[model samples]
Structure formats: structure tokens, C-alpha cells
Target: MKFTLLLFPLLALALRSQPRSRTGVTEHVTLNLRPGISLETTNAGAQDWIFQIVGKWSGFQDGHWGLELGDAPTAVYWFFNWDSVASHQEFTRSPEYPATIEKVESLASSFSAPHVPLQPFPPREVFASPVVSWVTFNLTGVANSTATTNWQATANDFLGNLTRVSGYRAHSSGWEVEDSRVFSVLVGWESAESLGAYVISRSFAEGFRRLVSGVAWEHRVLRVAGYVPKL
Candidate 1:
């Protein structure tokens, strides 16, 4: 199946009845592997350390960590959902926190962890999917109400088309809490090839052009190898 770019002006109104809460926090972590370190090595080390600290952290709802595909092959993307920012901060005070950081730092040359409240947090199936796409868009300027409204309409239109694409599984998005102008979207797909095919399609071309017009954005496709806590 292929998606088609089409406007649905009533999309927002149709979704109005479905309340979307921004209570939870999603931590997005990027780990750039150190020189000479293979993805296999990092995965193995992760299993022994970071992965083991999952349930131990209070408020940890769900987690997914996987090696990135395409451009940054040696990088890993880790997504962790928590009850709230306070919950995540509480975890940082735990004894295991330092040890976990030490283990991750050993394998990574550099890393960054940014927390955001992904409105309508993605379900577990999204992370369980074979491939995931992480896309971020930085608004050209301060996002006023007008800009946000326009973006939302364009996004809804684009997403409406996206759902029709073959292999599209699930998606979620939100603006960065620390930087409201930075918006991010997470999409799950059956395979990287499926996502690539969609990206080159006319639907994508038109939708993406409208969505990102005058905005700076980047994306990464990840081959999900495993999920934290095995589910």
C-alpha cells in the first residue's frame, strides 16, 4: 500500500474527544560508540549493565534500545518511558545510577539524554517493531500559537497519509520539553526497506515538503534488535 497526501481539515476536531495527556516523560538517549567498538560489543555490554537496571528503577514504564541503521551505524538509540520527570530524577539518585552511567560511558565516546513528554506515548508494539524511525524538526523561530496550529494541521495531514503506507506500524510525536521549538516523531515500520520506499514516494515527498517547509530536521532509522526486559 502507498500513502497519498490529502487534507483532512476536520482531523483535529475528530481527535478532540480523545484526550491526550502529557503527564509521562520519554527519555531519548543517543550513544556514539567509541572507536574500534563494534555494535555487538556494545549490545553485549548493555545486557550486562544498563539493561539489567530496568525494573529496578521506579516509574520506569517501558524501554527500547537498539543499534542505529543508515548514517550513524555505530550509534545506539535508547528510549525510556517514565511516569514523569520527577520519577526519572528520582532514579538518578539511586545507587545503581552511577554504575549504569559508568558502564554506558565506557562503551560510548559521547552521549546525550534528552527528556520530552511525547504526547500520546507510543505503545509497546512500536518499539517491538523490526525497524523504528526517529525524526526531529527544529522550528525556524519561536513557535507562537499560530505556527503551532499550522504545524499540527500539516502533521495530521501527513500522518493520515502515513498510516496507509505498507509496513507502517505505529507513531507518536511531541515537542522537546527543554526546547519547545524542537519537535520529534517516532515511527515503527516492518523494515527499513519499507520506510525507505515510503520516503521516496510521492506521498512522502509532498507531505514532508509541507511539513518541514522552512524547518530544519533530521532522522535516523534503527534496526530494533531487542527490547528492555524482553517485552
Candidate 2:
């Protein structure tokens, strides 16, 4: 009875000493800027307006976000770092968040829903060095839940092959959101040429056929502006 009493206080102390923060992850939003709008102008507006507000918001002591441009004049990407899913969710409820979204949506023709990395998926490993190509895909036609599971398994096998290619920094493939069949895959490369070389090679052809068949996909390659280390 005395030993049990002593152990209980120690356990209570240990639990009290535990940190409150959760593992950090990146929040991504792919924007389709308004038609005929130049990326330069859109980016300039974002820097002036959207970036400014998100910077002042709580839980973003790191900085607001990073921006990138893809192939088209209308394509833009926003990447924000947050301590956890709850932090990001909490930010959305802030008064400034809705107004910020309203201003940003005004610039885009359409935008993909914000996509944060899902749990049970390992936290992302972000390289310190900037990547030359940031490729993103929006995919559909994944029919049923079982098919989705099979696809993810096949993708895991495919990722094993992709990592062998030189200059492949990081790659992750998963659903764009939980409870949705639509999915996304983001890959980083050393350069556009490096990615091009791999795409045309025999190895890529085989994997692409197996994993991508029957899926309708839209993709764009972005020139990453800066790199953010994994938090």
C-alpha cells in the first residue's frame, strides 16, 4: 500500500510534465486564379493582403505561409505550417480567417479544398534544400473504399521504386480529404528535366499504367520558391 501510494504521485508528476504541443504538418491549398489574371499580379495581391492577415493570426508564430507558381499563369499554391490539425482547424474559426478566405477566393476562379496530411500517415520529411519541381495531382474515379485501399497499397510499392530515382526528394500519395474518393499525390524533384527523364523511362511507364489506370487526373508542376524544414 505504501509503494503504490509513492508510485501514483510520481506518475502524476510525469503526466503533468508532458508537453501540450502536437506534431507539426503542412497545410496545402491549390488555387486556380481567375481567368486572364497573371500570376505575378495574384501573388502580389496575396503578399499584400492574405499573407498579412494570416501572419497576425494565433499559432502561426513561425510565419504566415509560402507561395509557389505552377505551369499556368493562373496556378498558385499556398503552403502553411501548423503545429497540428487542431491548430489549423482552430485558425479557420478565427474571425480573420473567413474574411481572408473571402479575399483569396475573389482572386481564384476555383480552388481545391485545403488538404492537410492525414493521420496514421507518417509526418512529412521536408528537405532543407529547395526542390526544382513540385508536382501535384488531383485524381478521381477511385470507385469504392476497397479500391482506394488497394490503390494506396500499390502506390506504396510504386513509391519504393520512385525513391531509387536520383534527385527524388520526397513523395506522398493519399486522399485529398478523409471520407472522399478523390485523392492527391505530391512529389518533389531536383528539376523539371529530372522529372521529365523519369516520366519517359520504361520504369515509369510500367508503374504509371498500374497505379493510374481508370483514373482521371489533372496535374501541374510548380517551381518551389523556398523550402521549409519539417517541424
Candidate 3:
């Protein structure tokens, strides 16, 4: 029995190896909480947290952040080809879950959703790519119509000239001036090579620099993730 048990792990390893796998499953998330709010201090802190699933949540580390912050946070998001909503449900339903009930109870006052649009990616013909996702968030102070249009036009001009890339699309969600001034964008690249080309390509750099000069904000960092669905 001992010898057979020892072989089980090896068999499992051999059956589940995929050398070609290089990305994590993509997920698009957006957060909007009423007119005046933030989650760092009150919600994420509590004494008895027994329900939110807090393991292995990095799904899209390979994408890029293209925009800037808003007045408050008109929105927050992550977009990529996720396995499915089923996987998220499974994690929440698991017996060992931690932040499930606790978050709801703690965040009852702060959380408000004018929209809960979680719809499947409709079967459509996109450029030659395995999967694609797009995320949107509000950069609180950037809701002004004039500056954003110019930025979009100028930035779009630069990206338009970036050669040798795939699955490129852009969407602008509104921002809340009370929280921030500019909104951020999440764009996906098919492979590392494509990402490299974009960075090294002078056409893209010149355009990005010009856009950056217009809006300056303190305390800025970017978060990226890569995702691949197993389904």
C-alpha cells in the first residue's frame, strides 16, 4: 500500500503537466460604492473574518495599465479570459472560506451598486486570439469632457501606429471628480513579445509621454495579471 501510494503523486504529475501554459485565467472586475467611500480602512479590517475566499486571486499579471486615476474611483476592474463564474462560486461555497459572510456584514453600510453587470462574453469574432477581456474604472476627478477627449485622441493616435500587436480595443468608463481626476485603462497583449514591441517601439513611447505630461498625480502604481481559462 505504501509503494502504491508513493506512485500516485507521480502519476498525477505526469497527467497534469502542460509546458505550453504561460498565462493565468483573465477576470474583469469593477467596484463602485455610492458617492463618498473607500474600502482600505474599514472593510478589509475586522476581528472575526470567516468567509471570504482569500487564496490564489492573482488572475491577470500579464496585462498593462494604460490610463490614470480618477477623482474617487468611479470604477475598479480586472479583465481577462477567466475559467468561468462557476470557479468563483466554487471558491465561495467551499467549507474553508473566510471572507464570505464577514465582508457582507462589515461592508453593509459602505457598499452600493447601481450596476451589477456580470454577463458572459458573447460569442463574437475577435482578432486572432485565444481569449480577451476589458476592464473599466472611474478616476474620480477626470470626468471633465474636454481634457479626456483630447487625451483619448492623442493616445489613440500613438497606439494606432504601434505595429505587430493583436487584440487591441479601447473603452472609456466615466470618472467621479470627488475621488480622482483621471481614469485608468487596462489593455491586453497576446504574448510577451507583443508587449516588448510596444514598449521599445518609439512611436508608442513618444505618444505616451505626451499624454502623461498633461495629468500629474501623486502616489501612483500599476497592477497587472495574466490569465488562461482551463475550461
User: In order, how many clashes per candidate?
Assistant: 0, 0, 49
Residue-level lDDT of model 1, residues 1-231, one tens digit each, is: 011112122222322322343368788878777776665654586555677685567678878877888654778778888777667666666777666666766677666666678866744667868999998888856368798788878887787777799999988888776566878888889988899899999888988998888788888888887666522
Which lDDT tens digits does candidate 3 get at residues 14-90?
31332322322323323333333344334333311321123243321221111113344433332333233333334
Cα TM-score per model: 0.83, 0.68, 0.35
Write down the worst ten-residue block by lDDT for model 1.
1-10
lDDT rank order? 1, 2, 3
lDDT of 3 at 176: 20
Query: Can you tell me which runs of candidate 3 are displaced by over 4 Å?
Result: 1-145, 162-180, 217-231
Q: Which residue ranges in model 2 land beyond 4 Å of their true spot?
A: 1-25, 35-45, 60-72, 118-146, 227-231
Candidate 3: 10-residue stretch with minimal lDDT: 111-120
Residue pairs clashing, model 2: none
C-alpha local distance difference test of each model: 0.72, 0.56, 0.34
Best by TM-score: 1
lDDT of 3: 0.34
